[model samples]
Target: NLCSKNKINPLIGSAGVSAVPMAARVSNKVGLESDAQNFLLMHAMGPNVAGVIGSAIAAGVMLKYVLAM
Candidate 1:
């Protein structure tokens, strides 16, 4: 809904946090369904990787504090 209102690609949000390449591939597939020329895999991958890194960092921080206790 937000993507539709903001005119942003829904794939960015959908592919940001899980399944990494799989989500990007799914987004690319959906984009291709709409327009064969609209290739979005690369774009989706950017946020996907960033999300994974951010999640990893957060997990590390949480684990560090948990272990200290």
Candidate 2:
């Protein structure tokens, strides 16, 4: 519920101007094949093992920041 609210509310607030498509366009301009670009996006953003790893890395960064403080 919270995730949906956060995700939808932002899109509602910023309708028609999202970074996602722009990022994809820039990625495409970089000469990546469509399939390779999509695979890279999945590795970065997909709800799978790689996303879990990203979350873990983010958590570690937060933990380090807190410990430093």
Candidate 3:
């Protein structure tokens, strides 16, 4: 819904910590529906993993800041 409204790729839009490989799998499945050759699982991993690590780093930074206050 949000991806369609924003004109974003489903795989890219769905990349996140909780969603992770599940979202990538869904993207690949949907892509295969449209085109049998489509395989997005690996491609989606970069963003998915990055989102997880980035969130952890962000949380750490936020925690440090809050603790300093």
Task: Report the number of the highest-TM-score candidate.
Answer: 1
Model 1 segments more than 4 A misplaced: 1-7
* TM-score quality measure for candidate 2: 0.33
TM-score on alpha carbons, each prediction: 0.81, 0.33, 0.71
**Tens digit of per-residue lDDT, candidate 2, span 1-69:** 555645322222222223544443443434345344333333222233443566678899999999999
Quantify all predictions' global Cα lDDT against the true fold: 0.86, 0.43, 0.75
Better of 1 and 2 by TM-score: 1
Q: Who is ahead in TM-score, 2 or 3?
A: 3
What are the clash counts of all predictions, listed in order?
0, 0, 0
The sequence of per-residue lDDT tens digits that candidate 1 reaches over residues 1-67 is 6445567777677788757789888989999999889889899999889889999999999999999
Off by over 4 Å in 2: 1-47
Model 3 has an lDDT value of 0.75
The sequence of per-residue lDDT tens digits that candidate 3 reaches over residues 1-69 is 654556545555575554677867777788888888877778777787888888889999999999999
Q: Which stretches of candidate 3 lie above 4 Å from their native place?
A: 1-10, 16-18
Better model by lDDT, 1 or 3?
Answer: 1
